[model samples]
Target chain A: MLAGGHGNSNPNTNYLKSRGLWVAYSIGMLVLHLILLSIPPLSIPMAWTLTNQVHNAITFIVLHILKGVPWIPTDQGATSLLTHWEQIDEGRQFTKTRKFLTASPVLLFFLTCFYTVYEPHHFVANFLSVCLVTLPKLPLFHKVRLFGINKY
Target chain B: MDILEPMYTLVFTELVPSFHVHLQVLLGLLVLWVLFKKSEKPGRPGKAGKSELDIINDWKPEPLVTPVPAKHRGLNAPVTKNQIAQHITVNGVKCLNFATNNYLALVNQQEIDDVAVAAIRKYGVGSCGPRGFFGTVDVHLELEEKLAQFMRTEAAVVYSYGFSTIASAIPAYAKRGDICFVDEAVNFSIQQGLVASRSHIKYFKHNDMMHLEQLLSEQAVLDRKNPKKAAKTRKFLIVEGLYNKTGEMCPLPEIVDLKNRHKVRLFIDESISFGTLGDTGRGITEYYNIPIEEIDLVMSSMEGSLGSIGGFCVGTTFVVEHQVLSGLGYCFSASLPPLLTVGATAALNLMDGNPDLVKELNEKCDQLHRLLHKSETLARYFRISGCRLSPVKHLFPLELKSGTENELQKIVDLCLQDGVALAVPAFQLNDVKFQTPSIRLTVNSKLEAQDMSKCLSTLEKTVIATFKPTSTS
Candidate 1:
């Protein structure tokens, strides 16, 4: 077990609770972005720009909130877990692969944003697509184990 | 793009026109407020009503083990105002100082002051940035080169502060998986460095080479059991050239022999011994007639012996160069001020010019040791502890009465009242291992024969008065 007691036996319930909270946070952020998009003072391009800004702001705030939640591990906790696992060769390799997999969605979202900046016509589609891509990377959702298999 | 254009126009021209931006702002604020309010409510279902502050208020801090006296609660009287020489004014009284580390009494030397003043005029007080970022002035390089030359090493690296030099150097090379064999009686700075390294540390009895060898043999047995792990693990032996806590010199010859026999790297901290030990004062290596190249690294603080404000590590070029990129404090902290570096440079020049000063300091240490050793009054109350050559001496009580430290403090207070200054060695409360309460006296070269006699007379009187013998029935 890690210092934070992250390797508890009741993984299924903990994973579900964390996944549920992450889903709720992601939906709340999406609704906030949509509301900013529907504002009358913003033109189509302006609305799209406002939506991306709201997306970043809401994600940051929600991640901070998730850090305080017990079931979801904070970045510091994850780093400690990485260090603990690094003592063993197999576990170190596992952690490295897990980190790369975990980072892919955020990397993809930034790449999509970069391309959408030059082609503004697909801005709304790109924004929604990025939001969808980020869902699996959320604090709680990232911890979810499917069919008795741990994803992280 | 075409479908989105019509949709964008419809939303902007028709749908969004009915709703104002202000209302949208208010709606967004309301949603955020509700979300935050929900989060502010406790996550635990049963404890939703209690506020966060209420939980924090219920928490209590751990009580101190030994509560400090109310009179000593705040800052004590400032110890440094004028130069830390043989005589210093503390709380406006000129007292014979036996406390400061101005061993050679070069803190207020005319030549050093002149050079410092000149350097300040040329380069300002502060370095403004770390060494990597425009902080490396010419004086810093000069000091490093001079230090390397003086210590007879291929290269050396200077640290901005004395304490961080060893702390950063240890971790820079010895990472988590490595093993370190340390002496228990090393000063706090070395302890901090060992902690920072995160390496497997096995502490032997202080200055006990037999115990150290036993530990090494046991480690060898463990290594033989797992040959692959042993091959990968880097072993290091760390000891102080002159131990500050116990005020004794390390047996360096045996340590060097052990280092070769065990194939362990040797790192010696010569903070107290540098410019204080040896005939000409190159350090323990010179004092013991051991070649400097045998030791993997030699670290010393310029503050103690050189009467300056920084530290340096002397080693081969390859080892010293690694610290530039790896040593955290050297890379992160602002470089040593140009004035202080130049001051150290001047002091080095003085030592180089007059090697007799080092010789004189050694003679003074010996004289003071003999004077204290022969005092009947001191012999009745306390046992003097330290090497004859070490300037720093410890007076450990022969018998520990329940409140011996308080009694020692009373003697120190009385000595101060009588115009003689002494120091009570203080350690962190967490460090329960080597906390033998003793009065520490520092002997300097500037002290005349009469001055030593006067200080010894005052100490004898104070100790006798504090711990007067009671006749047995």
Candidate 2:
């Protein structure tokens, strides 16, 4: 009975794990974008190093940690955890809408920062004030299913 | 400082810090991953077989077949031609059968028809399975027994078709380490067998004995080290008895004598020569009076001249038995239908009965060759004589001027339009095409003397019309 049940469970777990890896990669990119925006202006080069270059360097180690940490919720059943994690279509739509709405504001913020550095203008100050006001309306990104710290 | 040290320092300084970090870390990880993967799946006991993933990666979809030109569109489309006696009616008008391989005029012969009908009645329609199981009919066994007697060998085996006999026989003998020495101009069927068997193979120049000797010498050295692994190694000399392209006999007596002296076994594919050479048409072995006993193996397609649909091989009992046991083409495939065997059996009997018919065929070939040689239009392209046509029967080569086979085909097509059947592009192969001097006009016993004359006259006219001398501008 143990052998038969284990045989049945093995393929399902393997398939779920493979798909989970893709999700983790996408979430990692999102986290990198968020951290870049949150960083100080003068440290932009340092932030670039931390996000893209540093992340790339330690990605293998992170992936190993992600795979080892079991994602299934201890309190909830395995089915509930699988269902939450497998909601890819819903997550993609949310990400798409969030990106479209935030695009102009993100672009304006970067442009204003650059111009302030190159050619100082009141337009840069005005843009920063407008960005701060609009921050309240920014859609909150909620992690629906947390596997582990490295994966989340 | 060393010159190499300065170069290395310059390369190291130029690389970006991020790139250097990524390269060192990622390269190590990638190497480790590959090593882990290799360790998990140790390769095959022998060499690694081609994987499905490899096949998929290498897959190249075939390019589409080119569409026919608007003018030539009807060439590929089927036409329901009303075939008549001595004339093929196409588009409701009478034309000749230039593409037909009805050499002996045996297709509709009363004697042949009667024999075929009787055999079909006696032995149902088909044996319906392979010879190993229920496919072997009494007639099939009898045919093989008779073929062995005819070819004058110890034993014989019949195959469902001409190509399968060739495709089966070569591989049945050749294994992993065997080296097959083949003629460059060999039929595609033999080539397929050699390739599918995965044996080491080499090619000699077309009809070049010296080139063959050189290849054999090269093989002898390779064989010495491995000794070709007794189970895997055999050196086979494969060539045709009568080259279907030239319609000329192989220098078999010479080939056989040379191969024997060099300790290599020879297998002669006498598809074209059988039923058209020798006193009784046993084939090239007898045509040259080289004892069949001296030749290692003989294979024949009973299609072109024999008016049948299958192939047969004659050799020692051991070889014949071995082929029956392991020849995948024979073992996996269904056996030849009994009706075709009936027809072949009839053809063999008829060939045995009619000695004079063979003599008449020789005479007809002689007459046709002489007439074609005399024709001013054909004389330039066709270099043939009486001896080449046949000593005992009608078969000769039409050696064309280089790259004129298509032009010869056009003339043949014109002959067809004028109600005379002609054979022009007889054998087509890679880098080689055989254009007969005149169409292979067989003077079968069935055709009246008048009919023969009319055919010759029509041929002469077609030649004249097709190749009118290019006037000097």
Candidate 3:
């Protein structure tokens, strides 16, 4: 029920590990950036920064903060203790989805850096957001909760 | 100090007030309406309706299921290409099946088949409707009567599917707001019942009486706190007579004592134990020498030891009668085919007429247990877990690894090649999954005594070959 359980959360979502997921994720990120860009007040750099922050915030909550599932989890409480990150790839380290999730945030960070430049504010915010999301995804933090937070 | 005071006044008066532009507009509109158009009706023309429509459009329904990844369970899984096998023969292989719960070796009986075929020809293939409707065939009544007589109960209700019998019966009596203390390791069917009942389910640690007692005492405290509401909440203690998951027997005598002390009605799912336990094959009560009348309700699937399809629940006339009209599986779902009911009766009769069949099964269980426990090499890698003289047994891997199932599958496949079908998950699992695996072994009375030893030696050799113990000191 904890870190040691299997299946890809659902049979229909078997595409989570498919190669097209990377494409879909990139497209979603691009669409998010474009939507932010459409805001009249936001500059190109600000839009990229906002996109990075929004992406990281969502991934942080979904992949790490929310333990267990929110819907009718057919597998009973088998995933009661696992976050979506831990649930994916059945808790095996260095799997495809884990690598993609870790890499996506860093990629967004670099993309934001390229657009925002080293202006202290945007650079720092994007860097921090990427770090918040990507750090927990490192193999070092597989099941670790540093200050006894959310262990249950 | 002067500059800060002025800044605070400026921000509060100017900046904060400007943030509420919509509020200002609404207030101005209200004043204008009050002054210039006092008699106008107050309902907004279209704004609220438009926003409501936007909100309705924005609402997204959640996916029907959230895939919570569950793992492989180690049961006596008869391996085919992948699907679970039937009791008679697994995946077209005529092997000594020590996988399914064919305890009395009644599955292969000619008499049962003869009765089943004759009845099938007479009644045709299906009952064609739910039991409550026109599906109550004459054989259905006969089988129910036979089951009641066999169990020494006042009456019984037969369900179309064995899995749903208890699943449906449980919800019939134990509805929302009821309290049920359940064993955590009871099979999926009982778990389904617990979930469907929407009851306050307190799961005691599997087969731990102290844990159950602690839960009961906690409930007592609650009941003491709210005696009025407590009186309305029915409390049930549910346990399996023989747990199919662990191949272990419940401490029935202790459970009975606890239930009595806690003022809880007891429900036992004897799916795996009904025909295998007692000398006379009357299940856990008979085996423990407890009177059948002492138990409030009894649920069992005939799929296992009865060597037939469907399931039954037996108790006093009052308890059993309630299920006939209210049990979801019995009332709404189609009844068991007449032929299956007929065949089950024949199988039960065979068990009733010859008690030796059950006695032999008990002996086989003991033999298997003793062999596994005493096997020096087998002991290191796997510790046997299950009740002695209970036909269901488990070999839990001492050091569970990622490849544990594969290793066990290899042993099972090897055994199958040697004409003994041992059950393990030759499970074709995806790349990302983990679960503790064990080898489940079932003992049948039909297995040859010499073949038992031969199977044991084969298991040892295969296990020894499959797993090269690293720390072989």
Task: List, for all models, the DockQ compared with the true complex.
Answer: 0.04, 0.01, 0.01
Top candidate on lDDT is 3
Off by over 4 Å in 1: A1-152, B1-68, B78-81, B469-473
TM-score for candidate 2 = 0.59
Task: Give lDDT: candidate 1, residue A41.
Answer: 83
Q: Cα-based RMSD of the predictions, in order?
A: 13.6, 21.2, 20.0
Candidate 3 Cα misplacement greater than 4 A, ranges: A1-152, B1-94, B425-436, B469-473
Residue-level lDDT of model 2, residues B86-183, one tens digit each, is 45564454654434444455566667667667866887677778888888888888888888876778999889889888878887776555678888
- lDDT, candidate 1, equals 0.74
User: Against the hidden reference, what TM-scores do the models get?
Assistant: 0.68, 0.59, 0.63
Looking at every candidate separately, what fraction of the true A–B Cα contacts under 8 Å does it contain? 0.00, 0.00, 0.00
* Residue pairs in clash, model 2: B398-B437
Model 1 vs. true fold: TM: 0.68
Write out the backbone clash pairs for model 1. Answer: none
- A38-79: candidate 1 lDDT, tens digit per residue: 788865455555555555545434432232223322121222
Per-residue C-alpha lDDT of model 3 across residues B1-473, encoded as one tens digit per residue: 96357446544566333423343344345333333432222244554446667867988999997665454344444445432232335556666667776777777688988999999789998999998789999998998899999999999989988999989888878766689998887777887788777778888888899999999998899899878667767899999999877788999999989888889999999998898889889999999999888789999999988888999999999988977756778877888999899999999888889998888888888888888888988897897888997788888889877777767887887877776777763323421122246788888887777877887887888888777754564
Highest-TM-score candidate:
1
Of 1 and 2, which scores higher on DockQ?
1
